[model samples]
Target chain A: MDLTTIVILALTGVLLLLSVIKDRRKTLAALRVAYKGFVRLLPSILAIILVVGLIIGFVPPKWIAQVIGKNSGALGVAIASLLGAVLFIPVIIAFPLARSMLDMGAGIMATAAFITTLTMVGFVFLPLEIKELGKRFAVARNALSFLAAVAIAVVIGVIIR
Target chain B: MNEKADAVANGKKRSMRERIRWDYTILFLLIPAFVALVVVFPDKGATARHVAWEYFKEMAMILPAVFIIMGLVSVWVEREFIVRFLGEGSGVKGVVLSFILGSIPMGPLYVAFPLAAVLLKKGAKVANIIIFLSAWACIKLPAELMEFQFLGWKFTLVRYLATLVVVVALSEVIGRVFFKQGYEVPDEALDGAEG
Candidate 1:
């Protein structure tokens, strides 16, 4: 297991033990809740995973680089931002992809924009977000995040370059 | 009155059931689509499966633990406690606490949304909740570590600071814009806002 995975497992183990010690009933209740929540989220999680698989499988890294390469400039940043907003790749995978893009001559600004937007904006989960957190809150947060991403990208570009 | 309440409750339950059913249908369709991809383009299909497997393994390990923690938090932490910590008038302390709580490694952004909703239901300030959600989404500790590993310390650190500043500002602005002063949002506001 990776360090993050191991750490999370250890933390969960410790917490679960403490909860069990504190109150067996509550601990069991917590587990039940967790199981229900897990089941509820299962389908969406599977769909997202499948979509990520399709994306990585179909879209070659070389192609990503060519589109967002150094010469692509402002347009590259915009494209990267849009793709990041739409795509739902895990951060673990996204970092490596960003690094690869950088190595392949993608501008630092474009890479930053991609990473920022990918995390901050979630087109795929919009329906869920809207359902949970009010439409106004969800839409406002997402729109603001997109704008913040662009601004962050510009600032990063200026500072790093 | 009792009969009306029961009807409303039943309607809510039916809607929830329908949502779940829709999710199941999507998953069922995706399975066949996945098979077709594998059959049509053997090379890309295999690669896709490999990538999917990697993610599935990761999710399997982390998601349960994350949900359990979430469950514990939801059950053990009283609504009053959350309100006391993150509610209106909590001010800068609440903002800082939200960031710290959110930065802890959890599963994914979608998971955080439910937790954020819970916080909102507990009367957490909108600005703080927004900051919490944004921090959970992007400024997570493990994600930052990964970024540092791949993109170097300078790039990671700069972006992290920038994101923090921007999110806090954005959240405050959004809160101000969406929620006017002296406006008391009812407890049922969120439920009523749903389509």
Candidate 2:
């Protein structure tokens, strides 16, 4: 395994061992709790993974890259912004995604927009957000976030371009 | 009967309008992106199968682990515990401690929220939790450092600033409207606090 994976595993192992040794009963109870927690997180995580896979499989990074690349201008930035909000690409995936987009020759503005929206906004998680925070709160928060994300994009575009 | 349905639809429309006003700038931004996509990129028809497969494969295992970890934190943990330990009322020291504590490792944004909710219910200050979560979700000091090494410091810094603003702002707003209404604090943060 890579160093990161190895470290994470080692850490998990150490934590697990410590918990077990400290109090076997508490450790067992914690494991049960953790298991239940795992179930709660399963659906979203799976959906996101599938969606990411589908996006990569279907959209062609080159096409995404082209739309967002350096020369593509404001239109490219808009598209990147939209995609960023809708897609759940985290910072980890963002690195490779941005690199691929760069390779595809996407403009700096588009890339900036993509990066901005990718983290700030969350179109896909709208329903869950609404459920959690009430519709008004979710809608307002996301709307504000989306705008803020775009503003960040615009600033980045200006600086980078 | 039809009038009632229409009224409900109208209410929905109004809500949508409010949301749209919040997002009008995105609409404006879209115009330029459309033009670029149409005019700039050539042969827009090609499919990117390999990249998708690679990303999918990598995330498959990782996501399950994240889910389980988040779930565990959610359950065995108590919200009041976190509030007592890290409430905003605790003052600057508490806020600073909250920030440091929050910046530690966690799961994805979506998974983190439910946990945040639990904390909110448990009595974590709306502002502190908001600040803590927003920064925790995005700033990720250690991880961001890695990103800077790879993607350049400028990108990382800009992202950090923007995300911080968004998180803090949203936290305040949510606190005023939702969490203050007596939502239950998350079990995990509470558990951590107690632990």
Candidate 3:
């Protein structure tokens, strides 16, 4: 791990210890709240994680490279955006994934869209979103993000394509 | 009037499942994650183990920190402070602040999600948090610097500019439309308007 991350981890540990030692009741309350939240979300998250595993199990990087790689145009941009709209992979994985896509010849525009939408949009998280934030906000945020993804992709496509 | 009423009635007739099936949020979130897993991680045993282990360690080390920080940020920070600094009325200043705050984020995107959730609960506007998290994931300062070393200044600048535009535009849209009734333009959000 990097120095920053290590530092943050150490701080977290210290804080947790302090919280536990100082106000055991509050600490326990917080732990309970956090655990309850985790339990509520667990089923859906686990299902999503399984689906993620399946995706990794099947699709090859070459296929992604073929669709969005260096020679791509409007179609490639659309495919990349669509792909992004459907996924919610962690940001940690996205960098190496994008790099590998680049290595396989994915165009910069497509890569940009893929990364942008991957984070912005939350298709599978909709249920959780609805449960947490309500339907209107969930719909609007996601819908706007989808359009924004396309617009961003096109803007990048124009500049780099 | 009849058509509108009919439309409302027709909509109400559908099951939550059916309505949810049409929810784009679910689909959009799933695809990129799916693509990442499919397109990124090696399928073979040894390579998969190496990649998984590395990522596992990184997440293992980072997640606890993320949870604690997120909790602290939520509990310690006041909603008014976040709104004044990054809320809608903060305008250009707010947007710039949000971008800077987002860009410096060091942990993973998932880490930001919980933080964003806490911020929302604490009264940070959805628009700002959306912009913050999205930008945090894409245009990380340290990560971008690393990329600059490999990808050149021109590419990085172009990407950064594009991302800024996208983040601002999308955040505004989300703020305007896609939120629940109670949270939509919360009364506290207007308190920052004059500032």
Candidate 4:
């Protein structure tokens, strides 16, 4: 496993250890809650995975690049951010796809915007987010996040270039 | 609402079988759709499985720990504590605390959703929770490291600083405009999944 996995595993182990030591009963209750909660959230989680698979399988990366790469100014940034907001591709995959775009003449700002929005604004998780945190909070966070992605891209563009 | 609380307190609530049927239905429908996609495009189907499998392995490894910690929050953490630390009057310290709480975890954004929900229920500020979710989503330490390795330090650092500034501003605007009245987690919305 990677560092993230190892670090989180260690932390969770310690927390579980402490809880068991301090109060076994409460810890058991906590485990029960964990179990029930996992079951409750399992469905949407799987749906997201399936959807991600489908998108990756169907939508060619070359096509996505052509949408943003075909332009270089505001239109490029806007298209990049919009695509980022909609796509559910994982960050690991996103990085390589981004590198390919850069090699093919995509601007740094557009790439930055795409990555930021893809990470920050998850359209795939909207239903789950809304269910857990309310419609207003979910909608507001996403809508603002879209704008923020472009703003950050502009800042980075100005600074880097 | 009181009865639900009582059910939780008693730890004897009935199985949430009915409430979860929608999820099962979605899963049922998705399986066939995916199968059809795979059958139509065999080569792309392999790529799809490869992408999904990588993430599935990551989820399988981390989710139990993440869920356990979430459960611990439900049982061990007090609502008053969340309020005092992350609520409206918490100031700059609240934002810092939210960032710390968010960055230390290792999971996809979706995993954080339930935790954020729990914190929201317990009285964390909407701004603070948004900050937490934002950090979890993008500014994660490992994520930045990955960026550095793939895109180089110059690109990584510039984008990192930019994202941090924008995340804070975005979260605050969302907080002020939408949750100015203090958003409440409606009881039925979080019905079966309090943990």
Best by TM-score: 4
- Candidate 2 whole-model C-alpha lDDT, 0 to 1: 0.58
Query: Each prediction's Cα lDDT score?
Result: 0.80, 0.58, 0.64, 0.82
True contacts kept of each: 0.68, 0.19, 0.19, 0.71
Error of 1 at B149 (Å): 5.0
Q: Which stretches of candidate 2 lie over 4 Å from their true place?
A: A2-4, A40-44, A69-77, A90-93, A96-110, A125-144, A154-161, B1-81, B90-118, B126-133, B140-151, B185-195
Best by lDDT: 4
lDDT of 3 at B61: 69
Instruction: For candidate 2, write residues B136-174 as lDDT tens digits.
Output: 555565568666876678877776666556555655666
**Predicted candidate 4 versus true structure: per-residue lDDT over B1-195, tens digit per residue:** 999899885653343455467678888899999888888889999888877777778877888887888878878888888889998888899999998888874768987876887788888989899889988888777667778878889988888777777888878888888789888875544443343
- Candidate 1 per-residue lDDT, tens place, A17-92, comes to 9999999988887787677767766787888778778888988766766677755489998999998898777788
Q: What is every candidate's C-alpha DockQ against the true complex, given to 2 decimals?
A: 0.56, 0.15, 0.22, 0.64
Better of 2 and 4 by lDDT: 4
Grade the docking of candidate 4. Answer: medium
Off by over 4 Å in 4: B1-21, B188-195
**Per-residue alpha-carbon lDDT of model 2 for A1-161, expressed as tens digits?**
34534454565566667666777766666565556544534444444444454454446555666656645677777788898888776577676778678667776667766876676567766654543444554565566566666666666666665
- The predicted structure with the larger TM-score, 1 or 3, is 1
Task: Report the C-alpha lDDT of model 3 over B129-174, residue by residue, as the tens digit.
Answer: 7777677767776777755665557666777787788778867766
Alpha carbon lDDT at B107, candidate 1: 64
Error of 4 at B174 (Å): 1.5
Arranged by TM-score with the best first, the candidates are: 4, 1, 3, 2
**Residue A28 shift from truth in candidate 3, angstroms:** 4.2
Cα shift from native, residue A5, model 1 (Å): 2.4
* Best model number under DockQ: 4
